[model samples]
Target chain A: MEFDLEFALETVGPLLMAFLQVTLVVTVAGSVVAALLGLIWAVCQRELPTPVRLPLSWVLDVIRMTPLPLQLLFAVAIFISFDGYRKFPDTDVETIGMILGVAVFAIHYSTYMAESYRAGIDSIRQGQWEAATALSLPRSRVWRAVIIPQALRATLPSLGNWAIAMFKDTPFLLVILVPEMVAKAKQLGGASYQYTEVFTVAGLIFLAASYPTAVLMRKLEKKLVY
Target chain B: MSDFFQAISDYSPYLWEGARVTLALSGGGAVVALVVAVVLGLCAISPVAVLRVGSRVIVEFFRGTSLVVQLFFLFYVFPLFGIDLPGMWCGIVGLGLNYGAYGSEVVRGSLNAVAKVQWESTTALSMSWPLAVRRVIWPQAWGLMLPGLNNLMVMLVKGTAVALLIGLHDLTYWVEVMRKDPEVGLWIAYGAGFLFYYLIALACSSGLRLLERRAQRRLGLAPSKTRTTRATAEAVA
Candidate 1:
């Protein structure tokens, strides 16, 4: 367990490649999924009738309440089981299964994202809605032109916060064998028995990436405040 | 459905053991987190620059890194330095430190939210800083911080699933094991886990909500029945 500087330096290249290729890609894609799906959930919650909205809300609550690793495991298990039933090649199954796992990640986080969007929408003044109504604007136009823009602006910082949260959570993708940064670090550590050096570097990389993003988000949050 | 029930019955003892571990980790971590939150939070707002900066750095570093890495570091690396912790202890410490960093923000925010007038009043009364904080500031700030802390607590419970990675036989670990058994099957294994976790989460949130309600009531933010009745009578009069 001596911290080998050389090994740590060597470890960084592969870890960063895994990070940029798998970890960063999953995060960016997951964030996009969260944003779009979360917005849709928010809008649906607001506009749908009680019968539909209540059940939908409950479902989202279950998603939000559960630990993400469980969701990923569950989704992967299902996909893997489905792969068993299908007449598919073995190699392609893992890649597709991991994609589905990332989708599950997006869906899980989207519940949280939906709450932020809901808060943004709730913060909109009644006057804006009334103004749209007084103008006799169509429902879709009012949503498109008036409501969504304001809510999106208000929610940008919180959305960014969720994205950071999602970024941190990308490590859990290792549960489903996604070969993300932490998984790469673990593999390197296992190979070299330099868990200290490798994991410390991995932790440092996480800190380096997330800390600045967090600071930037705080600044953006402050700037966005009227 | 019967097959699912059969799976649950077969695995109940094992699952229960895992649930106990999960609960233990969560409860222990929460205690650790509370202590860390208060200490770091106070230091963050302390008059001494070194204390403030030191605590801020610790908070940011813990908050920045992924908890899994931290857990792995503790479990795998710390032993190298002759600082061996049990697997469960590693999980608890990891959960505690990570969540504690987040909880410190809630603590700092709620403590800062206490009115400046209250601070000045303590000075007016010639109260010592600790006495003022213990008797005056904390009572008010406690109520405000509970809601945020409750949210974190629920999160901490969910986070205990990470304990499985550290070789702790937590609930998630049991479910994962069960999933590999064809008798239990994937659906039953995960379905049962989902229910168990959801129930635990629901219980934690509702229990915390009750505490929050009582705290709010003590602060007079929640309208007590007597107070509401009295106010209605006065309005009628």
Candidate 2:
């Protein structure tokens, strides 16, 4: 019924611990997976023949268009079904499974990231491609020496934005019982009926963590502008 | 599989109901978002310093926090403060405020994107501020902002899936419920859910693109043949 400072303060420690242990872990790992896989998707879409590219783009579109929570549920279901209903084993296997589930976040965001990468690649003028051709560079050499470095530079800020987005979405991991910050706050709140305090603190933590990075991305975007 | 098809046929009614709820949430949230976006967006670009600063703080606050926390706050915490919003209202408010903050940026950007000459021309005509905005600035900015808003609409449709957490019987919730049945199977339940969501998103985007083309045509600009998707992606990124 009222704001309880003591209980709110108490919830912060466990929530922060969960943020570091689960939320931060999933976000960092997911960002890595998304960046790598997204670049691969971008490159393949760009260079591969239409036969290979068309289906790949369609698959990525499906992944992008669906809700992340649905993807998370689908992923956890597949994990459970494949493992013969050995749900959340109390071992390293649980950790491994959680990582695998985090891949859903990666794959989902990778579609967006791939779009940014494609935009970056497209921004490269025809003159650059012609220069590479004019130099008689090998096909692989042109991509490696001339193309990727430039695209990566242009896309860096947008990629950081996606990482921040993935950070916020880490809470969706709750659907699969991943014990992230919000889920921990909910569990802690259930004991005292102080959902207000716990959720407030959790939301503030998210704002505190993400806002600075977003501002930095804005600055970087300005710097990168030609 | 026959079992998958049977499960779908057996639950088609429920699935359709869920789809309807999802659509309603998306539509409601979008209305709220559009209202919030236009108001806050206009205030964001207002000449008054206080209005600009106030809207900036509000937008950043909503944008900075995760939507899940916001939904939980409205559903759970606000009631503690005697606000007592319904679960569906919580979902709508949460989605609207969060995406509205993002959409406000789109609105602000497109408004700014209108040429400075347009603003000067309004002044040259001795037009009142509201009239100038309504007549001159808005028409040009509308077409420009539509693509960005279109992207946000697709994102909003996907975002409606989170309403399931608030106990809304949206499509995601139904798919989740069906997934609990061992016979229905995760593959079929989730696969069908994915297909439905994809279709909804595809429909929203294509619909918006048509609207965008019409707006551009009304502005007497030729519909751009390319770079629309790129522009939308860049705006969000």
Residues B176-235, candidate 2, lDDT per residue (tens digit)? 889898778787888789989999999988998999999998989999644334334333
**Model 1: per-residue lDDT, tens digit, A9-123?**
9999998998898878888888899889999999999999999999999999888888988888888788768765265565565466557766987898788778778877887
TM-score of 1: 0.93
DockQ of 2: 0.63
Kept native contacts, as fractions per model, are: 0.58, 0.65
| Model 1: how far residue A220 lies from native, Å | 0.6
Q: Best candidate per DockQ, number?
A: 2
Q: Which ten contiguous residues of candidate 2 chain A have the minimum total lDDT?
A: A84-93
Interface RMSD, per-candidate values to 1 decimal: 11.0, 2.2
Summing lDDT over every window of 10 consecutive residues in candidate 1 chain A, give the lowest-scoring window: A85-94
Displacement of residue B57 (Cα, Å) in model 1 is 0.4
Candidate 2 wrongly placed segments (more than 4 Å): A84-97, B1-5, B225-237
Which numbered prediction scores highest in lDDT against the true structure? 2
List, residue by residue over B114-202, the lDDT tens digit for candidate 1.
99999999999999888898899988988777767776787788889888677778898899999999888898899899888888888
